[model samples]
Target: MSSPKVQLRLNGIRKSFPGKEAATQVLDGLTFDIHERDFVSIIGPSGCGKTTVFNIIAGLVDPDDGVMLYRGQEVESLRGRVGYMMQKDLLFPWRTVLDNVLLGLETKGIDPKRALDTAREYLSTFGLSGFENSYPKMLSGGMRQRVALIRTLVLDPDILLLDEPFSALDYQTRLYLEGILMEAVETFHKTVILVTHDIDEAVALSKRVVVLSQRPARVKAVHDIALNEHSPIAARSDPRFSGYFHTLCAELDIQTRKSA
Candidate 1:
């Protein structure tokens, strides 16, 4: 009967650092809301504080002002509610792929046997079933990333914060994994927020894209993507798709020019 609750909310958030002359603010008064199961991407120029926004959302970095709320309530505890995947795979060289996937559960004291059952069930879908016992050093870049993704998924968090998770992979591999990851996200119905520089990547995988300005970043634009209407490959070639990309790019350029 009432308005749906926001899964995540950032209000008047700011982050600053001391510079030689004066304090430099990376994010200034940025505020936004992410609804439950929403696939949102944050895109901006380099040094735009996109990752800083993710860190604040993940409770890794405290904001200098304002508050972050999870589910209409202030998030005082974030131990098991948020899962983060960074650009690097961050897998342990000594542990096997399956063991790495179950690492989150180990921290939570979940039973090994139960965790294995859950981890194994999703391994085939992630293209890492046969390599369960293989060490991270033995796998390719894409495979290591799969392990990292599964490791985060194994945590079963309410929200997933992805910081350019596929930026390290080749273009072809990155494109392929986007489908796999999106399928997994659909299967799990995860509330995801991604930070990416690639406009096409943002359009392909996100329901909405949030564009921000340079350091002391603020929202510049919000783009809603509807790729389900077209195949990922085909969608990029669509005229409307390119139109949106250019529009966002133009907005970013304008902001950069203003700052300069």
Candidate 2:
């Protein structure tokens, strides 16, 4: 099968935050390419600026230098092209489950009736039909994430930037949500760029995994996962899984120590 087209490109991207003493460089010459409908994970240490890169891609922050391109067209800002979900679910406390899902559509001036219709369909697909009128505080971590994912998809963005969306969940719940997220991404034909710290999660959910070097993060290694088993949990059984995890850990350890 042919590979997907390059949907987004980052070349020599750099970002720094001003400090009282000196500038704190977060990303230095950060470069990567994300293909259409591809699930790519960026993994690195805690302070490696993985999320900073996502912020730049989503136009939440502009890079200090280098090019950001979409479909080979250079973009000054991707405000309308990308949908970003942070590590926190950040669901509006007062909005009903249905309302929260429709919030983006509401913001985008979509018809209310149409948004409601679409949200109900997604609620069923999300296995959240019975809780349409429920509040965020009443839902579990996994359920809230499901709602958050649905909310992001409701807008139909070109690229989905997931910054550790599953980090807050428990072990079993995380595994379950991975399956749900994979299904949702495929259902929407989305090009997902996931910023995560979990090596196993990255290997299981991604078509390619990009490891970053320490602060002033840059792409250290990109491993294209090849496994016949089609599910995140199933991929754990593959003999190659352990090797990938070990290598990723070793690379991360080296980066951490080098920075220290």
Candidate 3:
């Protein structure tokens, strides 16, 4: 047996934004490695730099210090190598579900027929087959998110950077989407780095949960989730689930108290 390949690495990453009084430091010497086909979740306090880390990984923002490597080579940007889905679905109201999912491939100048076929396949896989012609406004929140996820997946990026993609939906819908997301990851064999505030979600979906400290954020802890089941719902029922949940809660609580 061999260890998984390292797909992405963040080495001593540090960033700061200008504030009214002074520079507000966000990430401070943060470091982590995302292995190929591994699902990793990042969690921290409210104002910690979780999203900033995603921004750096997605090449939307550059860290003030530190190096990022992709497959052992240092890279300045990962613009096309990573697919990002933010909290908002950000779907165009006018485009039909199919068109929305086709947006990424179309932008990349893919052949129309091929792109359409790919979009249709993903739409069907995500259970949006009959809703192809439906507009975003006509769909439920969960369905719209499913479409969003499919749109990202259709691009087939090496890594998926998900920033609270399921936060806005109802709990049941969130759970369902979690299952859908897991399926997508397995079906696509993608490496994922998810930024979430939900501990349970982190525990349920991740192979490892990386906890960050308060801003300027650093790695506080990283726990390898050893649940017997992979399904989010079923993982929760695993005997060790509660222990992991409580331990994560305690980690966050201690950080909160220190900051307070």
Please tell me which predicted candidate would have the highest TM-score against the true structure. 3
- Pitting candidate 1 against candidate 2, the one with the higher lDDT is 2
lDDT of 3: 0.91
- Report how far off residue 237 is in candidate 2 (Å): 1.3
Q: Which residue pairs show backbone clashes in model 1?
A: none
In model 3, which runs have C-alpha deviations exceeding 4 angstroms? 254-260
Comparing candidate 2 with candidate 3, which one achieves the higher lDDT? 3
Cα lDDT computed for each candidate against the true fold:
0.83, 0.87, 0.91
Clash counts per candidate, in order, are: 0, 0, 0
Residue 213's C-alpha lDDT in candidate 2? 91
Error of 3 at 170 (Å): 0.5
lDDT of 2 at 253: 76
TM-score, cand. 1? 0.91
TM-score-sorted candidate list, best first: 3, 2, 1
Better of 2 and 3 by TM-score: 3
Instruction: Compute each candidate's TM-score over C-alphas.
Output: 0.91, 0.94, 0.95
Residue runs of model 1 more than 4 Å from their true location after superposition: 1-5, 237-239, 254-260
